[model samples]
Target: MNSNVKVIEEKILSNNWYVLKKITFDYRNQSGEWQTQAREAYDRGNGAVILLYNADNQTVVLTEQFRMPTYINGNETGMLIEACAGLLDKDNPEACIRRETEEETGYRIGEVQKVFEAYMSPGSVTEILYFFVAEYSKSMKINEGGGAEHEQENIEVLEIPFKRALEMIETGEIKDGKTIMLLQYAQIKGLL
Candidate 1:
């Protein structure tokens, strides 16, 4: 919509799992001269993440799983400890988080507070992530949550002290962006 830029053309680079497109565009420079630029963007849809905490227990629920991308990018083990998250296939953000929490962490939570939303990576990825926080207790654990079986998800649930979760960040053990953000949010806001 800006007069400073115009998309020249877009080509589908790949559509195997999600859509990746090569975008060529005409951009007006600082001097008002048009220049051609191209960039590749990956569209994997949007997702939601949540950090579940229990004030009484001073604990937070987290999940661990193998991440192929992390493995290839200098992560020795490729295993990442992250907050429960999932792509919002067709549900609203709240519904998506609720569903993902139960599926990934085995907690049927009620009343989640939307903390914020952010783009985890914006340079070449088209995904805006929604974040949430909720109070949880042992009474809510309904099953051994390890993600959905049909989706081939093999998530490991972990419940640890809130203070320990923060230390994991310093130890470089919890490197996931969304998870870290949520944990920091809890700490700054004294949610625990």
Candidate 2:
């Protein structure tokens, strides 16, 4: 909580899926003058993302899904390749990521290394995304994971060579920010 700001009013703008609120506040500027401002913030809750890598195989596991926002914004097919991720509704970051990984990738990984957390779209969405990396082998696969049918998620799992995955970035094939960040992290740390 910054002492430099005070909430004046808050109103719900929309309550369809998550929550959208319009908040008016009094902000103390650098010059020590108080100014009134208003902003709309969407609270979709925090989430967790993970990159599963196979050091022995020099491969990485990723997911492909259709994103409506991308479709409306100019993405030709609206299908995006990204690291496995899910919202932390009531579970902790680790548990949420574990469940998401199994549901999306068919990998029942045992150990995971947390990398970092970040707010992906701070300007409008209130979501802190926790990031992680884990080692995986063929033996870890338990089922043919697509996604939860109840949630209408149609996710596709992808396993690509670490080097080829990097090339996809240059070719504009993998455009998701979290996926790009995780891939770069792996490269920097020499995970593969």
Candidate 3:
């Protein structure tokens, strides 16, 4: 608890898969006045995302899946192209990403490099995403990774040329924020 703010009350809105809470707080304004405000936060837990690339082939691996939220918003098909990602369910960022990559992309990557972390949608979602990148080779392709069926994730793996992937970003085909960030990072660092 910060000295500048006091949590007055908290109410749990939902506790289905994760949690959602409505909080009321009294914050010390810059003018030295105590202002009461309310906000709802969705805590689905922190997660990790990774972009796999092949330096020799100048290619990158991505996944496509249906995202209900996007469908309800404006996306016509609700299908989105994204990097491999999963919630950190009692596992560290590195381990979680490695498992997700294999489950989503079917590539058992040997090593991954932690690039950065970001709080995506911090306004109403308390999710801090760990970002990573790794070099992938043909030998790493082990299983037919379409995500775990028990979790109801039907993902399509895509191996696209680096230049074409970058073009897709400009064309609005790949609008996923995490995937775009990692792709841009790879381009900037000459990791293609």
Candidate 4:
């Protein structure tokens, strides 16, 4: 254990879908001197993204939703095109992802294959996102997708041809960082 790296205190700042905490820690810098730093860390709960693929139609399921953060920042429409994703509340990554997939797209994924795990915006946030892809078939039916009502999510699920999804990326329509990374990884691995 690194003795210099110690968390002195932690304070909760927010407790919405994503929780924010202020942390104070001491660490040894390259100069070999102990330094104290304070950071506002976002505990976004373990997040997960799913790439739902329809094997028969060669398509992928995606969602479009209004993101206030993006809207406030500069997106003209304030809408984002992304894979089905959500924050894990006490559940493991796989289970959380599977549940999110069903709630967001009405797709019950079978045999999820883990693709990647990464930190989203590590500069100040402590969100670890797990990415997975599951083979979907036309036989899969949509019961009723729109996210959980308790969370006030108004999601519109869309199915796009695999090739068109790549086009959306090239056209700069898919702007979410994690979604881009996962799609690129899938394409590179010839899984798209």
| Residue-by-residue lDDT tens digits, candidate 3, 54-137 | 999999999999999999999999999999999999899999999999999999999899999999999999999999999999
- Which pairs clash (backbone N, Cα, C closer than 3 Å) in model 2? none
Q: Write the candidate numbers in order of decreasing TM-score.
A: 2, 3, 1, 4
| lDDT by residue (tens digit), candidate 1, 1-192 | 899999999999899999999999999999989999999999999999999999999999999999999999999999999999999998999999999999998999989999999999999999999999999999999999999999999999999899999999999999999999999999999999
Candidate 2 residue lDDT tens string, 6-35:
999999999999999999999999999999
TM-score of 4: 0.92
Ten contiguous residues with the weakest lDDT in model 3: 1-10
Off by over 4 Å in 1: none
Candidate 1: which pairs clash?
Answer: none
TM-score for each candidate, following the candidate numbering: 0.98, 0.99, 0.98, 0.92
The whole-model C-alpha lDDT of candidate 2 against the native structure comes to: 0.96
Candidate 4 lDDT score relative to the true structure: 0.86
